[model samples]
Target: MTPHELETILTEIGLSNSALARHVNRSEGNVRQWRKGVSKIPDDVAEWLREYHYFFQKNPPPQRKG
Candidate 1:
């Protein structure tokens, strides 16, 4: 995916770079690179992000107890 698309998806999912990195089993730096267009986003990661975005839209996460 293009960096712009990746950034948009991440925003839609409401996930920080660190959170995405954890979910995708990658380093935060890797996610940063993808977001910045410094590195290519793998096809698998892009696919997973798209799926996650859909899930996030349909079933937003529950609020944390405080």
Candidate 2:
């Protein structure tokens, strides 16, 4: 996926670069590289993100009983 596409997906999912790095067990620097197109986003990672994003969109987390 393109950097812009990644940015959109992250925005849609409310995930910051640091949070994505933490989730994938990568360094923040790596995530930045992906975000900036300095490094290519792996196919597997991209597909995984798309799948989870679709799932998240369809089945949002329940609101807390505040």
Candidate 3:
């Protein structure tokens, strides 16, 4: 996904960069790079995000809705 899309997802998911990095088991620097469009998200990280998106679509967090 594009950086803007990723940032929107992150906001929709109610996660800051640090929280997202922790959730995805990636470095905060990597998350920052992704958010800034400084680096492309790796395949594995993209897959993880997709999976997370799938689960989230199925069962969103209490504070968020479709």
For model 3 the TM-score comes to 0.77
Candidate 1's C-alpha runs over 4 A off are 62-66
Candidate 3 or 2, higher TM-score:
2
- By lDDT, who's the top model here? 1
Higher TM-score: candidate 1 or 3? 1
- The C-alpha local distance difference test score for the whole of candidate 3 amounts to 0.83
lDDT by residue (27-61, candidate 2, tens digit) is: 88988999999999988778878987999999988
How do the residues 1-66 of candidate 1 rate in per-residue lDDT, one tens digit apiece? 899999899888778999999999999999999999999999999999999888888998898999
Please give the clash total of every predicted structure, in order. 0, 0, 0
Query: Clashes in model 3: which pairs?
Result: none
Off by over 4 Å in 2: 63-66
RMSD of each: 2.5, 1.8, 3.6
Residue 17, model 3: lDDT of: 87
Clashes of 3: 0
